[model samples]
Target: MSSPRGGTARTAPPGRNPAPQPAPPPGPNPEPDSTGLVPYPAEVAARYRAAGLWRGHSLPAELMAAARAHGDRTALITPEVRWSYAELSATAERFAAGLLARTRLRPGDAVMFQMGNVAETVVTYLGCLLAGIRPVCTLPQHGTREVAVLARHLGARGLVLQADFGRGQLPEQARALLAEGVIEEAVVVRGEVFGKAVGYGELLRAGTGNDPGTLPYHSRPPEGVAVFQLSGGTTGLPKIAPRQHEEYAYNGALWGRTLGWGEGTVVLYPLPIMHNAGVSLALQPALLSGAALVLAPSADIGTLLDLIERTRPQVLPLVPPALAIRLLEEPRSHRTDLSCLTDFIVGGQKLPLEVAERLRDELGIAVRQKFGMAEGMFLLTPSGAGEWIRHHTVGTPLSPLDEIRILRPGTEDEVPDGEIGELCVRGPYTIRGYYRAERHNASAFTLDGFYRTGDLARRHRLGGAPCYSIDGRIKDVINRGVEKIHADEVEDLVMRHPDVAHVALVAMPDPVLGERACAYLVMEPGRAPLTVATLGAFLLGEGLARYKLPERVESVDALPLSNVGKVSKKELRQDIETKLAAETV
Candidate 1:
């Protein structure tokens, strides 16, 4: 599906309302501008420089500067507490010092983190940055098995974890792994018991002071690794992408400016900060722009609504599922004053047209679709609430330094606009290669060096500016709303089933979950009979996380084959859709 076109600024000369018409081609002046380049306001340019993001992907200097500039200003606000910039910086400094003292971690060491949308996640993140430690963020949804597998793959020197953020309980898992000689030490954030583990409270106490203002500072390269954002799990293995601090800073500041943010801008961060959208769109942008960063620790609709009411944030960057169902829940309307809201940027998955329409018509807020990745490239332009654009398009591309190209899925040839292909990106901020994954990295880039996004997209223009609309993923990944599952992993597990001959996992559209896995299996002849429930049980027994297990299974005598003799997952997905439709009817 494609999103609607963006609106353009028109000139009526003296004192007349310009007649509504099709927007002119993309440029600073659709009508006529001599410069030929869209000149950003001087203020926007100044803010970029002042925010310390004008360079490449560097953020430590800017983060330090912003925290110092807004020393007394509230940097982070949650239902439970608010942390001033000074307080956050100080806690981070102390936490950094404590980590340094307690572990062998040093500058450039990769530290794995799994925490929720709480204040500690931020503190620990900043702490890692300040200590010159690179952080690899993991989703809180991962169970012990996933964490163990990913952590082992990362070979992380340190781990920052909450006691029991979700089903995982990473700290306990880390401790158990340590006992099993899998890992060395684990750092606990909050209330989970672990012997010989460092508690976050104690780390906070080790900081500069209650004032946190007097802490010493050390400088690092702007191009240094700030955070290692993991690739979306919709693929086989999650790759760790090293985000530079400067580019990250620039992204945040630009996002702020795009929203007309300043000191008064209050942003609600419901998505976990570990995500690129969260860190770049919400926390980093708000901090850099001196806006209030409101925190919604839980995605619960009631809790989210309550926080929104109390905070009255101007921007809410959240995934679409939470907004859709909650906005339509009976009582249907919240009495809260959401008047301050200027934009509601939705990403992670495409926002359903019904949900967007209701949100715009009922909630009276602009529902802007954004396409972004942990790798730093993004698309954030205002889209018309038209059916074509809303349902078919994503939005226009952002980041002047970034270029997106659509290529034929199998071949490395560029494809015509509107034709679905593998999305490849080349940009100052986009990663050249994933950390330590040489073979995959080699395959991930073109010979000329554009990072292959592995996502299926169609190129388009919105009001003359280059934009893209996401159709589906070229990779074998499933987006289950909040969670992502690697199709290959599941297929591998399914192959282990004695009764299963072969299997393919594909995402089926779900109203609430965004997408759910539907497995099409070719059972071994004469093997113990296999059914949907039995396959699911076998998968669960194989230790696949609940969220990753197939929600529906279809037994097929043989998998549909493509012209190339490969199993046509597309046909399987279509079959699943047909079955689902038949059941619903």
Candidate 2:
């Protein structure tokens, strides 16, 4: 869900860690501004620049470099189209010029994007970067509430959406947002023309720039905001994190080197391109490394498997456990020739170690567990770290310049190295502040400038390198009056059970205790229902405290996932409340 930017308990803004940088330099905006574009402190910015971390390079500049270095190389492959490095570079420029020529969109104005894994999203995202437009990446699953809040808050200049998504929801939401003066224009892809909707393809063709490669607007500032990604997971109101160009570029290239990315690396992306993980961890890295990015038509297991068999990509980034389960059970997965794939980068939510083991042992591939956030922190198991590090932890921070602290909850004091505490971090890649939400920033970051990541973590050694183990988010705890039970700790225990296929422990409201633990389970076919007493005994035997035990047990065929593929505790909590309300009636 959301890392409460302020203090709702559900929060994790983005990624961070390394040695603590010197006290935030005071050169940048001396204080937070109302526009919500929080600039890094002056001293901090100067330090990074001196350290050679904040190079004056933007994403469009990187694309131009890629085109120059590997002009004839295949750069992008989607079911509908394929483009080489030169072509991709030219297309990005064309799309940029087209936006300038056709749309009322001005430089620095925000363009809201709601699309799937299709190539159009990628094209538009890069085009926005090149055109000096900030791409606010809203998920395809976001509904009216998220759209309205984001558009209105960000003052989005345009809405770029997929015609095929949300039945008729996005278009209606776009119209409403426009009516409320939240958006100025709407651009639809592969859908019917309605109102002032402009066709995506038509927009790209409207370009007539003779030399589109030249960096317009004085080469675009390296520290300029590149895009807006939803902070944390898909569980709460969408909070936009304005990622800067130079720092964002560094992390993407760092990931390539960390994962041993090279010219031959072929990436298959199945997640929404508008997501932080997709753009930062996959798309940008792939392009910079001279790799080909193959965009799957959809996240469907069978469809992805067919694409993998045909494409034989070297790296497959991001595998959610549910999709892993589906992949394991799917008949095509057994026969699919995925031998070329060397690493399966798993993230979105904390992936159980067992899933990694299965990916390697069962499927004969490597697993790189990653912990990435929209606000700019990225941790992934490196390519040559071996399986021990990959299986034991989510690996080290992508940037050595990233600093991390395992602080006791709600405090800046560091805990014992091996003990669990809130993971607070700040780095070159992580956002200094959220866009336009000044009230939330006060509680979101510490006085020293570290972001208080609401996830529980402990530092551990994997070989000689330092790595951290995530102990679930602080918001995932089930509060029983004075006592708190970590949902993941209980879910981990339940997941070990022979009959349980998947389990999610969430807090259920209780009149006296305020909240109690409820275990939502997905079991193997024909398994008997799990009783609260049975789970309690199992947890007790496993040495969990009595207060930590589940008080209610519910079973479903599958746990509902958010639009971004996170286990939707919001829905589970709602279900529990609904059941309780019905019981009272």
The model with the greatest lDDT is 2
Best by TM-score: 2
Provide backbone clash counts, one per model.
20, 18
Question: Could you tell me which 10 consecutive residues in candidate 2 have the lowest summed lDDT?
Answer: 1-10
> What TM-score would you give candidate 1 relative to the actual structure?
0.71
**What TM-score number comes out for model 2?**
0.92
Model 1 lDDT on a 0 to 1 scale: 0.66
Q: What's the alpha carbon RMSD for model 2?
A: 5.0
lDDT (Cα atoms) of all candidates against the true structure: 0.66, 0.77
- In model 1, the Cα lDDT at residue 456 comes to 80
Model 2 segments beyond 4 Å from truth? Answer: 1-30, 166-168, 213-218, 232-238, 386-388
Candidate 1's C-alpha runs over 4 A off are 1-58, 209-217, 234-238, 330-335, 383-392, 475-585
TM-score of each: 0.71, 0.92
